[model samples]
Target: MKARASSQSKATLLAQHVRAGKVYRREDLAPYSTSVDRELRQLVDQGALHKLAQGLYYKPKKNVFGEVPPDENELLAAFLKDKNFLSFNPSVYNSLRLGTTQLYNKTVVYNHKRHGEFVLERRRYEFRMKPRFPRPHQVTPEYLLVDMLNNLDDLAEDRGSILAAAQRKLASFDRQKLQKSLEQYGSAATKRLMKRWQTAEQQGSAA
Candidate 1:
């Protein structure tokens, strides 16, 4: 009875910390008690949480439509156990007015851990271990430009037109931030492209 009561008490405390539509891991609940494993299993059986992967779990948030999976931020946080990741739907490029209308079916996650593609809760997430990304969780226009160039070879769009569009929009971006991003995260080829672009823009400005 005492052991059961203690387990229940710890579970209650842990439950208070579990937010709906959020992903968690056993390590995340370690501060509450040492019996987190047992209590987490109990919670899973009780339908309070759903197991995602080996150590990953989610608190399902249901609406009239049915259950919704946690967003990429929540899922990746639990998977990597660190928030050091950048995620974006590659399809976002189509909406960026980047002269590409083709839709992609993958959510790319750039992180220090994991490589290749994974399907979580019916959503495709592709993980690539990157040394640097300009920001976490969201894509900025400047970074998008860098990324588009970095993955240019794999893109289905017309490279010439895209480059022309990027050239036209160069002044619309934050020059310093874009330069810093290029210094940190840009590949050799990407940097070369930027250098040429910057030089051309300088000459154009002078003219």
Candidate 2:
């Protein structure tokens, strides 16, 4: 009877610390319970928390539509345990007006750590390891343009037309910003193409 009371007390303390709509790793709630795994299991059984994956949990919030899905940013932050990752759908390239209109079903995460596909709480993510990628807020049209060319072969669009369109569109972008993005994110092929475009632009200006 004494042990049961103690267990209940621990669970109560842990419950008090949990916030709805927040994703948590097991260690984040360890301080509240001596037997965290036990309490976590209890919480799961009680429907107070949903198990997202091994060592991960979510305190769900409900509305008229039913349970709200976990926020992608919050979910990624908890899974990676780092805020430095850049996450977006390939569909974002469509905004560049470079003739890409495919809607991708997967999200890509560019970070220094973790590579390969993972499904977290029903959302699929392709984590690609990169030595450098812009911060979320720093992502610009120039950056996306360079990235599209870098991943050209992987895209389903007609490469030749896209390349032709890109060349035509290059003159409209700020040269300095485009050059900087190309330097930072462009692949060898993209760099060479951009160099040729820059040379042609310079010659056109001279003429």
Candidate 3:
């Protein structure tokens, strides 16, 4: 893409959006028009804006101290914009830094063009063809953690920190709501994990 004559203000706005850490939807930039977009692309090509994926742009974060730059979840989301993506156990697995040290659980899951097997970032991400996704409310932190208990084998430990971690995470959790959620979605993979974790707790106390 070649540079085009454009308002410098639009370019500044684009940079602001990237600085704010919000993913850009092409439509969001509609106010700026095609010419502005062309300049945005040019900016990306010049290494000013990091092109996360088609139409998704970002500005690189400065690495502070010796800590490596954080894994840009926004970039990952942009990278996987095409697939039916969801933040799942993989995110938790990544947060815990528990799986194969060399691997990144991507760790998100989505239905990608109905392909049974696929690879990204040298990691395997699964896409279920059934095209099922939970409502927005169902993917909360508590629910996701419980869901991870089952979907991620690493989180499901027979005698490890999993119980403690889950318990700690859910300690202040509203029992009534979690119980209700369990009843409603228990058949779900995430819900099943909540059950197993509960079972482990009960069994441990009985011992």
Candidate 4:
């Protein structure tokens, strides 16, 4: 009876601490109670929270429409335990006017945590552990240009057309920022592509 009462009491306290619509892991709740696992499970059954993955959970935010799905950044932030991640899709290149119409089935996250693919809430996320990200938790234009070239061979687009389009679009980018990004995050192949593109553009202008 005493143990059951303690569990109940702890669950009540935890409910106050956990924010609605916020994702949390076991570690986040450890300081609240010793029987956190059991209390968390009870909270799930009581409709106070929803279990996401094995160790992930969230308190659902409700309204007239119903419970809202977890925010992508918030969900991943809880899972990764770090907010310093860049979330983007290969298809973002399409917005660069590069004529890349290929659809990507997954979103890529560049971070310091887990590498490879994962499925969260039925959505595919590809996490890449990089030595350094272009900018913490952001995908800048210069960074996109560098990354698109770095992973050019992997994209499901016409390689020649994409390259030609990227070369054309490169002229519109901030030259200094592009050069800086290239020096910091670009691969050798990307550097080569940038060099060739710059030379061609210079020659074209001179002609």
Ranking of all candidate structures by their TM-score, best first: 2, 4, 1, 3
All models: lDDT?
Answer: 0.83, 0.90, 0.52, 0.86
* Superposed Cα deviation of residue 113, candidate 2 (Å): 2.2
* Cα displacement (Å) at residue 94, model 3: 12
Q: After superposition, how far is residue 102 of candidate 2 from its true place, in Å?
A: 0.3
Task: Give the Cα-based TM-score of candidate 4 against the true structure.
Answer: 0.85
Please provide, for model 4 over 1-207, each residue's C-alpha lDDT reduced to its tens digit, 9 standing for 90 to 100: 998888888899988889988898988888988788889988998999888887999899988999988899999998898888888888988777787788899999989988988887778999999888855445678888888889988888888998887776777998998898999899998898788888988999999
Worst 10 residues of 3 by lDDT: 97-106
TM-score on alpha carbons, each prediction: 0.73, 0.90, 0.44, 0.85
Name the TM-score of candidate 2: 0.90
lDDT digits (tens) for residues 87-188 of candidate 3:
443544445423312334444454444444445324454545335545545664444444455454543344245546556556466677667655543447
Candidate 2: 10-residue stretch with minimal lDDT: 4-13
What value does the lDDT take at residue 108 in candidate 1?
87
Full-model lDDT, candidate 4 = 0.86
Pairs with backbone N, CA or C atoms under 3 Å apart (clashes), candidate 2: none
Better of 1 and 4 by lDDT: 4
List model 1 lDDT by residue over 59-96, tens digit each: 99999999987887868877877788888777677665
What clash count goes with each model? 0, 0, 1, 0
lDDT of 2 at 127: 95
Best by TM-score: 2
For residues 1-207, could you state the per-residue lDDT of candidate 2 as single tens digits?
Answer: 999888877887899999999999999999877799999998998899989878989998899999998898998888888888999999999998989999999999998778999888788999999989999999999999999999899899999989989988988887888889988989899999989988997899999
Clashes of 2: 0
Q: Which candidate tops lDDT?
A: 2
Error of 2 at 62 (Å): 1.4
